[model samples]
Target: MRIGRTLPPAAAPLSVQEVLSGVAALFAGKRAVERFEAELRQHYAVPHAFLLSSGQAALAVILTALKRDRPGRDEVLIPAYTCYSVPAAVVRAGLRVRPCDIDPRTLDFDWERLEEALQGGRVLCAVATHLFGVPADVGRLKAAAARYGVAVVEDAAQAMGGEVNGSKVGTLGDVALFSLGRGKGLCTVSGGIILAGSGPVGSAIENIVATLPREGWGDALKALCYALALVVLVRPSLFWLPRALPFLGLGETVFNPGFALKRLGAFQAGLARGWREKLLRLREARLRHATFLERAGVAAAVPLHGAVPDLVRFPVLVGDPAQRARLIEMSAEQGLGVAAVYPEAVTRIPELQGALAGGAAPQAEQVARRIVSLPVHPLVTQRDLERIAALFRAEQGEQKGR
Candidate 1:
């Protein structure tokens, strides 16, 4: 009768072994960090990989390095409907933000609009995000950026193991960043990886990381809190506690850019090193759910376009703001862990108003209003999927009746 068992929006499930390993890592030190970097390099087949404090830090580092090389090209082109952190990182890197509208169907860049932005000039780089585990056409995006001589940075923060035509998502771009936060594919509680092509960009990243300060005690403590929080709150039952607290703002989106740029802590690295294989398994589980949902008439947040997605969450557009709101509320009331991905488009967020590229992003705005993501993490069960499908079916029936 209780449908509301808390489902984590995204998670790296905690285990006794993981807990013990994390404790042991407190003494193991930066060797854990080095080990993770090596493992990541081998997995992605990238020649260079650096472990950093967070995904946002990874982007900031890459952007900073690219900005250093081309001081005159100060603008970074990003999809209009992406994490606030994308534009935040651009601003952090001291570059101007140029928002390109996204296709409602693909959740990737609107190709024509992107070309317009690129041809307009002054674009140092363009970010291609594989949103909600759905892979973008990075190859096409790259070809487009290549025409403008603009570098492509792949935001695989949510799609760590995702592939497109046999190539890993992270390796498709000139440089890529992946997150290991609470709800990402790999969670060291909070960590990130930067992988870049072995060229000027790679060299630049290396130089910058070498000069960067190591994670301080404060960062390590924060990682500990994240670790503890995951163990306690990652389940669907307890997640509601955080959601209910207004001040915690558990699910609200904001554009504050005050992140501390630091290197990855050794403890977080050790926690993550053993989890890469687990993440691949989770990726498989999510893919199964995504396929079932699509077949059942739930529209994907982004169209697959033949690319494989290692989705962090399964997102869909419920159609219209009111209907989407009803689904989110009804699903959550039943403990379904259905939720909005982002509250607004990047251009619409009050803080980032100055960052827009001076045009209306109608698609981004529309997608923002109707989009909601459902839990497809490792913990979601067959029963949970059935419950979710039933809810969707019921909603559809209601719409038909209307």
Candidate 2:
């Protein structure tokens, strides 16, 4: 293991002030949660904003609400190559997962396949994800879903601060969810934000959120501990310690559907005390790093159009799996923070074998094998970017020689 600075594949480091704010919030009561929700509503220009324990919980709540609106439609359309948490949330809401094939170049759904899925008549809603902060064409998706009277859940879990055509991403769909988990654009240690319009769907969402339990003192204390740990350990210099410990599962992609469904903890909301300013700073830094990687031409990046993504991690495609594995291994040795985002497409997850409804997603599968995300978080340095570029250049030379 490297003894020097070891970059985390992705991170949004908590400041000492943020942790102190969280501690103080433990005693602030519901005011903290309400204040945060108000800020979310104002920033996103949405009338209804709710905070949940996790992004998956928020999604599950939204799915449940949408399902109630149209009980006959039980299936949710999702990109086959999205975060596993997506499908897991769909299943958690007791909805069937119907994954649409995605375009490898953009990480968005393959338009033809998505159109075909929308016409299937069983889809209650479709999730338009801004994967790796790269915006998916939600306008077109909404147009299609509207034809079938289906709702669109914008999955902005990794794109809290992204923008498209000058409009914030969270405002694009019927309802949107943003994750405030660790490594996301804004870090609250752990939390989720939901934005919805003031309609029947919003009322249903409010009702469900009201019924959920809030995090008790015990949960608040645990979140504080986690936030404190993140404040120190998330840095490149000390990150290697936790990364070396196998039990920590530092960068593993998990697919478990069993997760707590509760309101966002006061402490977690407090941790985001100055989220607007902090989010902007983080987005700017990530954009700088991502631009460097894109200019370096180490690999082909996910395409972007009319969108300024607040990229948490810059994703690139390495065509050969063996070469991709080598790049990841080398990155680990040098502490350069390159990561293989997910091991496989949602259609291939063993746990969801019988739960999913879709045909083969060959493009999604290919992307699963070829894609790797490079660090673009604020913690990454100019030297780190150069080192990462050099590593990819060396790999290309080796590939050519073979």
Global lDDT scores for all candidate models: 0.82, 0.90
TM-scores for the candidates: 0.95, 0.98
lDDT of 2 by residue, 1-402 (tens): 778899998899998988889888878989999999999889888999999999999999999999998889989999999999999999999989999999987899899998899986899999999988988999999998899888899999999988888899899999999999988878898888899999999999999999999999999889988988899999999999998899999888999889889999899989989989988899999988887877776554665432336788888898589989999999988999999998999989999988888788999999999999999998999999999999999998889999
Q: What is the C-alpha lDDT profile of model 1 across 96-145, one tens digit per residue?
A: 88888999888989988988989766899999988876787888988988
* Model 1: residue 142 alpha-carbon error in angstroms: 1.2
| Clash count list over all predictions | 6, 0
lDDT minimum window of 10 residues, candidate 1:
299-308
TM-score (C-alpha, index-matched) for candidate 1? 0.95
